[model samples]
Target: MSKVILITGGSSGIGKSVGNFLTKKGYTVFGTSRFPEKYPQSNFPIIRMDVTKPNSVTEAVASVIEKAGRLDVLINNAGVGITGPIEELPDSEIQKNFETNFFGPIRVIKAVLPVMREQQAGLIINVTSIAGYMGLPYRGIYSASKGALELLTEAFRMEISNFNIAMTNVAPGDFATNIASGRYHAPVLENSPYKQAYGNTLKLMDTHVNQGKDPLEMAKAIYKIINTPKPKVHYKVGEFMQKFSVVLKRVLPDKVYEKLLMNHYKL
Candidate 1:
């Protein structure tokens, strides 16, 4: 049977790439965006969804169920990144990051679980990041968000194993996507104490992101994991990320790993 897949934050970046690729592979792809009208009637039918809002998530799922009848896979790819030293960041910005990056997925999962449980088969692919495994210099908040998602996926996988539902956490390294530009920044950029300390790092972050792996490579890896006879709980998509970040993080000493990441980010 052709898989029916739903993806959040499908308007652009990796989510959009995955949606388009999956539709071409004969899967019925439905992507969610807050502005449903802005999303063209392309291969994937775009539905209005805002992960931070549980009601919006419920409405989106209802609409998808009305049309697709069955949701074979739900890809929690919606997320936002915020940068700054944890010490220098405001409490509100940090909370907002969690709302969009961590709790957003939780809301969508809650909305989709009932239907998937009743159907007795479904897959959930959470688009986490390499940051989930390691702490970075300026992206502490964003990393924390993904770290929460990683733990959530771990528990989700164990709890649903007997129910024929699979949860895979895709931890990709940096990719050539619009994430760097699209991330939200605090309004206190000019007046903040961290402005000088983190401003340059932010510029470097943007530059390095442009040099990252092709997003389509990660999209293909996601597709493969979904189609595998027995899917794994964790899937690392980027070549460099899978080679060094995920594997080394498990074996390397904490100080050594921290030093390596520090050097890479020039912190």
Candidate 2:
């Protein structure tokens, strides 16, 4: 039998692309959405799920296992982006960002672990971002949330290795997706001191994302990870500059790297 794969936020963007690609590759793919009925014509099955809700995540995973008899892969790709100066962003907004980008994956991972443990083998992929490696101007919360997930995934790998399960943190740079349109913006009052800087940085961020890589590239990378017997603990996908930034952040002097990042974002 073909492998059964479940992907969150599969109604659109990277998750959708990965689901479609895997389905064509003969895997029984199931994608989750808050409103599954919206995609009645999707090539792969759509499950009703809100990753932020533990009950919703549990029910969705249960439905997949009931129908497929087994789940071989779980893709934690559901995430949200928030932008603004750290001082201006409300505490509630920061929590909301983490709810989706960080805790959402934790909810889904917890729901699937029991089944995967019983099976004694499975693969879990957490779709993080290059922003996870370093703080970004106007996107500090988004970066922090992804960075938190990356660290959690690293620890999770160690915990689950004994069960013969595999986990990978897939970090992609800017991608041409609707994420920017859907991103949350902290309320910028007319009198706010950081308003002009926020606007400039946000505009630049949008420009880079608009010119970013296609989501298909990420899908292909995911396919290879699923097929590999032992995939790397982490995978970075994107153009040269983006991938190199991760390496530079590690090897470059702290002050030099900070200067490079500030210069790149015009901060």
Candidate 3:
């Protein structure tokens, strides 16, 4: 039987691309969306899921297992982007971002762990972001949320390794997606000190995203990860410079790295 794969946020963007690619490769793929009925018809199935809600997550995973009898892969790709100066972002907004970007994966992972443990073999891929590696101006909360998820994936991998389960954190750079349009912009109060800086940085960030790499490239990387035995714990998918920047941050002097980041974002 073909492998059964479940991808969150599969209605669009990177998750959708990955689901379609895997389906073409003969895998039984189910993509999750809060509103599955709204998406255009496709070969793979759409499962209703809202990762933030525990019951929703549980039901979605159960539905997949009921139909497929087994789940070989789980891709935690549902995430949201929030932008603005750290101080200007309201507490509730930050919580909402974390709910979707960090805790959402946690909920899904928890829901699927039991079945995967019983099977004694499964692959879990958490889709993170390059921004997680370094704090980005006007996007600190989003970066922090992804960073938290990355750390959790790293720690969870070690715990689950003995069960014959594999986990990988895939940190992708900017991709040409509708994420920018959906991003929550923190309200900048009139006369807020960071308003101008936030505007300039946000503009630069949007430009970078508009010119970002294609989502298909990320899907290809994910396809390879699914096929490979003993895939690495972490995969960085994006332009050479963006991937290299992660390495540079590790080796470069603190001040130098900070300056480079500031210049890149025009902060």
Candidate 4:
């Protein structure tokens, strides 16, 4: 039987790309969407799931298990983006981000644990971001949310290892996706102290996304990981510099790295 793969947030962006690629590889792929009606043309079926809600997660998992009889892989690709000066961003937006980007993935993972344990063999891939590796200016909340998920995945891996259920976190750099359009952006206030810096930084971030690498790169990387018998705890996919930035933080002194970031962002 073809392996069954379930991807959350598969309606578009990286999730959709990965789902389409896996489908072409002959896998039985199922993608999840909060609004399944919007993606009637999706190659594979899309299950309705709101990772923030427990009931939705339960129903989505049950639907997958019922249709596939088993789930061989799960790609936790559902996430939202948030950007603003830390002090300026509303608490509600931050909470919402953590809900979708951090808690959301955890909710889905918990829902699938029992089923995977029963199978004795399963793979879980958490789609994190390269930003998670470091706290970027004006994107602290996003970085924190993803970083939390990354650490949680590490802890979860140790617990699930004995169950023959493998889990890994894949961090991708900027990919050409609709995330910028959906992400919340705190207005650049005219009289706020951070107006100038925030405005310039926001423009830069958007430019980076606009010129980001193709989503196909992420899709290919994920496909390769799926076929492996033993996947690493973490995988990073992106341009040389974006991936290297993570390494630089490790080797550089604290102040030096901060200076580099400030310089990069022109803070």
Q: TM-scores, in order shown?
A: 0.93, 0.98, 0.98, 0.99
Looking at model 4, residue 111 earns an lDDT score of 90
lDDT of 2 by residue, 45-111 (tens): 9999998888999999999999999999999999999999999888998998999999999999999
Candidate 2 structure, TM-score to reference: 0.98
Against the unseen true structure, what C-alpha lDDT does each candidate score?
Answer: 0.85, 0.93, 0.92, 0.95
Ranking 1 against 2 by lDDT, winner: 2
Tens digits of per-residue lDDT for model 1 on 1-267?
788899999888899899989988999999999897986755688899988888999999999899988898999999888877787778998898899889999898888888899999888999998888777778888988998999999998888888888888998888889998878664436777777757778887887689888889978998898888678877776756445776788899988888887777666
Q: Identify the leading candidate in terms of TM-score.
A: 4
Candidate 3 lDDT trough over 10 residues, lowest sum: 186-195
Query: 1-267, model 3: which lDDT tens digit per residue?
Result: 899999999988899889888999999999999999988696689989999899999999999999989999999999999998888788999999999999999999999999999999999999999999988778899999999999999899998889898999999998998899889987666798987788888788889899999999999999999989998978999999999999999999999999998888777
Instruction: Identify the runs in model 2 with alpha carbons over 4 angstroms from their true place.
Output: none
Q: Worst 10-residue stretch by lDDT in candidate 4? A: 226-235
**Which number leads on lDDT?**
4
- Candidate 2, after superposition: displacement of residue 113 in Å? 0.9
Clashes of each: 0, 0, 0, 0
Q: Which scores greater on lDDT, model 1 or model 3?
A: 3
Candidate scoring better on TM-score of 2 and 4: 4
- List residue ranges in candidate 3 displaced over 4 A: 188-190
